[model samples]
Target: MDVAEGPSSSSVVSEQTIEAGHTLLLKMPTGDVRPHKIEKDTTVNLGKFGSFHANHLIGQPYGLTYDIVDKSLKVVPPRPIQEVEDTEATNELINDGEFVQPLTSEEIEELKKQGLPADEIVKRQIEQHANYQLKTEYSKEKYKKRKVAKYSKGFSTVIPALYNVCEYWFNKDATRLRDIRPDALSQILNLASIRPGGRYLCVDDASGIVVTGILQRLAGEGRLITICDIESPPAYPCMVQMNFPKEHTAVISSLNWATADEDYTPIVASSEPPTGKFKSEGQKSRLNKRKVASDMLMRHREELFAGEFDGLVIASQYDPWSILERLYPYLGGSASIVVHSPQVQILSDLHAKLRDLPGYLGPSLTEGFLRRYQVLPGRTHPTMNTSGTGGFILHAIKVYDDPNASSVMAHRQKAKKAKLEAEANANAAPATSSAEPERPVSDETLAETTQPIESSDAAMES
Candidate 1:
């Protein structure tokens, strides 16, 4: 199947065609979202909602709601009102103890077995409910919604943007993706300066989540070299679901962590090709596989050795410094390096180390706190039981050694020392009293002045 190429780096903000090989989030009638890869001519079973041919969804616009009607596909009409207004709120709620429906589970099963239409089945159940009249309009709407979620055979297709993909994994298996929330991932991407046509070296141990985020930002424009162990190749289930074209995915190259820096001495290139005379079929197949592995190793290792990648992004279990120390040399001058860890201490230690290093600048540690809210008009408030932290990130940039920087730094140190000394001197100096000093009269001047004042007083008395 010929999958369409994804939008360019600048054009992906808009919607595109839903083609085969594209990863899409299927929103079930019950509001459950599942990420699925669109393979051509495949059957997708939505369990109780029944199954549909994958081809039935091809060419449909994303966010289009589809319904399975009488074993055929149909587009669900858009609702006139997208949301229930706060004015529609009602106080009545059906108690869980109340089983208002007259139909038993067996009767519902019997109706389902008769191949009755889903809507017809739901309508029957609603009509049979004992509290059907007691329900307020809002309660009735809620009841119908609950029933539709169970009996409806429909789904909404959503374009799985990076945020959607992350949310899906977070809801499904957060531990698998290292709990790197979408907001945290965004910070990493922005701090790392991920851009189109830039080459990046990455350590993705978060089930390829980090890899996917980097790839999406690059938008099929640059090479993203990933470091992986031989035992576990960087296989992200999320990435497999994305419908990115072969060329876009080809930009993500992997190098074995152990042999990332090793010279690619191609043993396969030196070995003679297997001959029919000496090789059995099985042996020949093994030889071909070995050659393929060798070639792949050589290709990735050559790229690893090539001068300076644009950035380094690591999300791994190993010590961030250990990984950085090994890969730091390969980063270009002024390249952004971002390390993410769930534990704060690891990043704290890394920050202390990187900040003092000559080749790096401002290794600041930061974390993201996301608080979700129920955004209803009248009763909007923060959602209960929401996760507070995605993870912690350590962001820094690689720097080149500058001989003149030492002198500049020395000058700054001297200026700082002088300023400090000047402050100390000012503080140490004693305060002088501003009051007028008493003038001491000399003995002769004081006697003459007193004698004149006394003569003037005597004359005045006479």
Candidate 2:
């Protein structure tokens, strides 16, 4: 069987519409998003709202809203949210009861069975509502929105970019991502200075949320070496969910912490040809797999040992200081180092530790707080609920640690102290020495006495 290759450079650049096997997000009318992989001739099930054939979405541009009509999808313009104005209507006489809507469950189900459109069903319910008219304009709008959220059979296509993936995972299970919000992840990328063609070292224990962000920013360029656990392979469920193309994922290389040590030797693949045929096809396949794994491991080990990474980004369960101690040497001079942790205390401790360490500068501990807002016209305000704390980030820069420079600075400080001491001693002796006739010092003697000190100071300064 022939295997398919990844998109070419031009295609990758120009491709915008959804394609078969592309993973995309579906944002339902209820403001819920679901990840879906497009497959031809398959049906995508959206519970309560309905299901639609996946082919209808294929080749379609993203951000288009589709309404299910007779089990088929049709592009529909999004509902416009009108600016609600103040009105005299009040809820004083309005009764809040289950019977406020005259439409019964049986009737609604019957309407659904009859294949009535969601909009039509909602309109009928509104007409039958007992207190909808008695409420204010804002309340009426809110009521309609609630009904729409429940009955609307429409969804919009969303691109599974880094932001979208982070948001989806965060909303679904924030703990799974170590509570790293989208804003926090963005900050990490910025602090680490992640860019194309730059090599980065990452220790992501947040199920690949950090790794995914790094790779997405790399955009199919540069290298990302992630450290994983010794026992198991790196688990990047979040990255896998993004469904990146082969070229984009090709830059990622991973090795276990145990193998990252200098003393650990990776098994290299033999260059010699095979001497005999395999006993069976399965045996040959297994042997080939082993060879491939061995070669990849060796290559990754070499890439890591050959240091000078552009940046280091870590979101791990291990002690941040320990990780920094082990991987600090790999970072290039002036390389950005960013460590993310769910607990601020840990990062705060790390921040203080980095301050006293050589070669680390401007260590800062920061926590990101993200609050969403409802941007509706004439009703703009912060959302009722917001995420508490994403996480804390400890950022610092790694510089060249020159032993000679440090020694020279120390000598200069020592010489300056000695000079101050000698001046003090001379000032005390001057009063006693003034009583006797002091012999005039010759120019050559004075120059010789001070020349050594001046030369030494200049050498230390230089």
Candidate 3:
């Protein structure tokens, strides 16, 4: 096993430790998923399934599947069980569910009110079923899955990957995310050439979906400057849910585009001391937070004016061309620019504008077409419902804008002319006599030459 390199100061949850405040993906036995923020000193209630102390999850490795066990319903690894036998005898026992042991709603409610263990309740229900012994091993497995979905008190902790979060948001509300599907987001990352150690300028108006997606590629190793035009920073609901470490989150610098050209200083402390001792602790805490926020703002401003960015990504409601026209100047040579929009007309106009622009290469518009398939034995086909459009994307690379455009073009023409002339000279010149003796060194050649030490020393000795 390999040892951990070191610890990071950011509050983001690492793979090894699920700390408090970290958002996790809790998957139910029914294949349903939901996001749960790990609050300190509180119980995470999963409704009918059960509840576990938030502290119970802290310090646990991510992606570990835990089963709710015992009276208090503590989380623990599931106990190993024997695999089901798939014999012909068991297959012959399959029964249709037309009529079975019918239990009234009140009876089921009474069983639940008794607080009986889920396994015990399931066993009792199976025993009461009229066709209990008639189920094939496969049928029994299917029955168990249904019961587990209804009564199991267990969940698996999943690392909230950017892709997963995007997928979750797509499921939750595609419209809010600008209709950016997971596959579409993947294409955006690819087209933008997002990677570690890159400096990116982003217009993340989609609640930090683009920001978090970029961070996944950066992997806590790059700079992200998010430009917004608002009084308060845009609420990155999705990014906050990811709980990126303060250090990694530190990489993301937010700036108001209105003041991006202006310089400002951070307020270190209040000029006037507390007027009275009546100020509560909450007020003092709020003051300190403001100071910290001011300092962060100053830092982000410093970085924004520092240098050109490696890439520009926009997933905003603003006109893509307008945003790019203003920001394209800040992109370094060969920098990629990617714009995502649900409508085709926006990209179509942007494509025309980019073509007219001088310092862009291959400004093309592309669409991400995705279709999922359901694969199972004897039941494999394209899923019935698929997103009609993942959205249109525009990609282009920045190029050096030559100050002397005419001069540069003239120079290229002259060089080509020189090359052709030289080739003509080589071909038209009289063939060199291969048998011609080499030319003897003339006075000009001898004047430029330095005799070897061996010959000079012999001459001097003589």
Which candidate tops lDDT? Answer: 2
**lDDT tens per residue, model 2, 344-367:** 888888877787766897788888
TM-score of each: 0.74, 0.82, 0.68
The per-model lDDT (C-alpha) reads 0.75, 0.82, 0.74
lDDT of 2: 0.82
Per-residue C-alpha lDDT of model 3 across residues 1-462, encoded as one tens digit per residue: 345757665545454478787888888766678889887889888876677777888878777777665423345666565466764545454445543535666776688777766666778888777776666665676676577567667888766777778888877788778888899899889888889999999998776888888887887888988889786667888886576766677677777666454444443466223784527777777777876776677767767766589999998899887787667767888999999888899889888777766687778888888888966444468999888877888898898866554443345556776786787854333323322223444566575565444557658888
The number of residue pairs in model 3 that clash at the backbone is 2
Model 1 weakest 10-residue run by lDDT:
428-437
Clashes of 2: 0
In angstroms, give how far residue 84 of model 3 lies from its true place: 9.7
> Which residue runs of candidate 3 sit more than 4 Å off their true CA positions?
1-14, 70-101, 115-144, 261-307, 371-389, 401-462
After the best TM-score superposition of candidate 2, give how far the Cα of residue 182 lies from its true spot, in angstroms: 0.7
